[model samples]
Target: MRKEKLKVLLVEDDRIEVLKLQRSIAKDLDNYELTLATNGKEAFERIEEDMPNLILLDLNMPDTNGIEFMQIMKGRDELLHIPVIILTTSNNERDIHECYKLGIAGYVIKPLKYEDYEAKIKAIFRYWSLNEFLNY
Candidate 1:
């Protein structure tokens, strides 16, 4: 593994969900350097400031929701290439279709069980880290 941690920006509004992800990363993903943004508006600011290797986004937020954010990213040459994975609870067909249309890297439903959620998190980290997106 690389000594330097991978930058991972997570855009989520739910406080409880945020806490859950944080704990999972702290316990399992030492290779990632996680950053938090409550909404798409804040997400852009963080992206500009640091440039994460990967982004984990939630579909529902207070402002500038995930779809809107993806639309905006498509127009920006600098930000367009950053991979975004949807980590949301929504299973609506439209939401999935729209997200895939906007070119999300992956879509993962947030499992109801904490253990299941943690497993997904681990899998995400393992796959991404193995590819070593940060090396690019």
Candidate 2:
């Protein structure tokens, strides 16, 4: 049987961070598709069209924040099943707890160093690949 190529939707406003993540994912050259959304509103629009297998959301967007976005996602029957991972720079306890309450699959804090960020991205890939829920 052939494996399905995973599609990942990234919601982030930081250009530099986006570049870094793209580079890290490029290293593996795996069977994956990446889509970017500069803000929560754009993410929502894209989700409405066709939802990705997974979502990497940042907590502090300008138009709409990640938490608010998650709330809306939960309300939509079509989007509710897609797993959401909070990948952000925020380390606030309240934000973390709230994300869990909102049913985030994972919460990852952005690392300061490029190498660390790369490792984190790799780790995410590894984890998702091994996770039974993904049903590869």
Candidate 3:
């Protein structure tokens, strides 16, 4: 039996970051379908149309930030269940604490090295693939 591809919605504002993530997903992960959103507002709209199995969120954006996005999702039944993993540069203690309070599955700090970043992304996908999720 063939396994279904995991749908992933990535919310990030930086074009370079988006491209890097896209490339990393293509190179490291198998059986994943990615959807991109530049900000929280766009992500919310995308989620409304079709919810993904997982969300990769960035903390800071020009429009709505990750915390705001999580808050919005928390109120909605359809979106509340989707696992969000924060992949961001910020390592602020307050941000980390707040994200956990907001119900993120995992918080990953983006690495400076390209190889390290790719490895981290691969690991996240691998772990999630093995784990059973009710919503997916």
Candidate 4:
């Protein structure tokens, strides 16, 4: 049997961070289909249009942040099942604890080094690829 590409939606406000993620996973086309949403509002729109297999969210966005986004998802039946993994600069315990409370698959603190970030991204894909997911 052939493996399906993982459809991922990244929600972030920082243009640089978006670029970094793009660059990090640029070579994994066979394994991933990446989509971007600059903020929570756009993320919602994207999800409504094409639900992703996973969500890569940032904690500090304008208007609606990661935590708020998760809260909204928790309230919605259709959106609640998609896994969300936080990729952010925040290392605060409160942030980590809160994200877990809201049901996140993983929380990764963005490393200062690009190599480390890339490695983390690759590792994340490797880990998630082990699970079976429903195709949308």
Candidate 5:
């Protein structure tokens, strides 16, 4: 039997960050499909169309930040089950605490070094690949 590819939704506004994530996914991960959204509103729209297996969210965006997205997602039963991991540059304790309160699957601080960032992304993919999740 062939395994289905994991669908990932990446919500980020920065072009450079999106490029880095694409590179990381292309280089370090396999058996996955990625969908990109520039901000929370875009991501929400995409989710309405087709729910992804997981979401990689950035904390800062012009229209809707990560927290706001989470808040919106929390109210929807269909969307609430999807795992959302915050992949952001912010290292603020308050931000971390707030995300946890919002029930994030994980919080990752974006590393400055390219190699470190790649390694972290690789680990995330590997772990999620092995882990079990409910079929939607």
Candidate 6:
């Protein structure tokens, strides 16, 4: 039996952050097929096309916010099963609570340093990689 490579949908608006994530994931985690979405609208389209194993989503977006996106996703049975990890800069209590309410798999605050950010991303992948619960 062959292990399947994880497909990651990265929904981030910042260009530099996206690049950094790509480089870090490529360097440390080789078994990921990554696709980017610059805004919530784009992310929605991407989700419709291909439901990735994991979604690294940013809360603040142009077309639509993460909260709204999550609401829409949860309503759809077909896309609701896919795990969504909130990777965002907002560390506010309301944001965290709201995200949890919306059933986000995990929430991560974006670090100022690139190395720390990379580590956090790696940790998320590592946890999911070994956990059988998310395999479904």
- Which has the greatest TM-score? 1
Q: Write down the lDDT of every candidate, Cα atoms only.
A: 0.89, 0.87, 0.86, 0.89, 0.88, 0.85
* Per-residue alpha-carbon lDDT of candidate 4 for residues 54-117, written as tens digits (9 for 90 to 100): 8999999998999999999889998888999999999999999999999999999999999999
lDDT of 1 by residue, 1-136 (tens): 6666778899999999999998888865668889999999899999989999889999999889898989998789998778899999999999999999989999999999999998898888778787765677
| lDDT score at residue 4, model 1, on the 0-100 scale | 69
Worst-scoring 10-residue span by lDDT in model 1: 127-136
Which digits, one per residue and each the tens of the lDDT, describe model 6 over residues 13-55?
8899899888777865567788899988898899878878889
Worst 10 residues of 4 by lDDT: 127-136
How far residue 110's Cα lies from its native spot in candidate 4, in Å, is 0.3
Residue 30: error of model 1 in Å?
A: 3.3
lDDT (10s digit) by residue, model 2, range 1-136? 2176577899999999899999998956566678899998999888777768889999999999999999988988878778998999899999999999999999999999999999998888767656666663
Candidate 2 regions with alpha-carbon error over 4 angstroms: none
Q: Is 1 or 5 the stronger prediction by TM-score?
A: 1
Q: In candidate 5, which residue pairs clash? A: none
Candidate 3 lDDT by residue in tens digits, 5-66: 67789999999888887777786456777888999989988887877888999999978899
Q: TM-score per candidate, in order? A: 0.94, 0.92, 0.92, 0.93, 0.94, 0.92
Q: Which residue pairs come into collision in candidate 1?
A: none
Give me the runs in candidate 5 sitting further than 4 Å from their true place: 28-30, 134-136
> Which residue runs does candidate 6 get wrong by more than 4 Å?
none
- What overall lDDT, based on C-alpha atoms, would model 2 receive against the true structure? 0.87
In model 6, the Cα lDDT at residue 118 comes to 86
Query: What value of lDDT does candidate 5 attain over all alpha carbons?
Result: 0.88
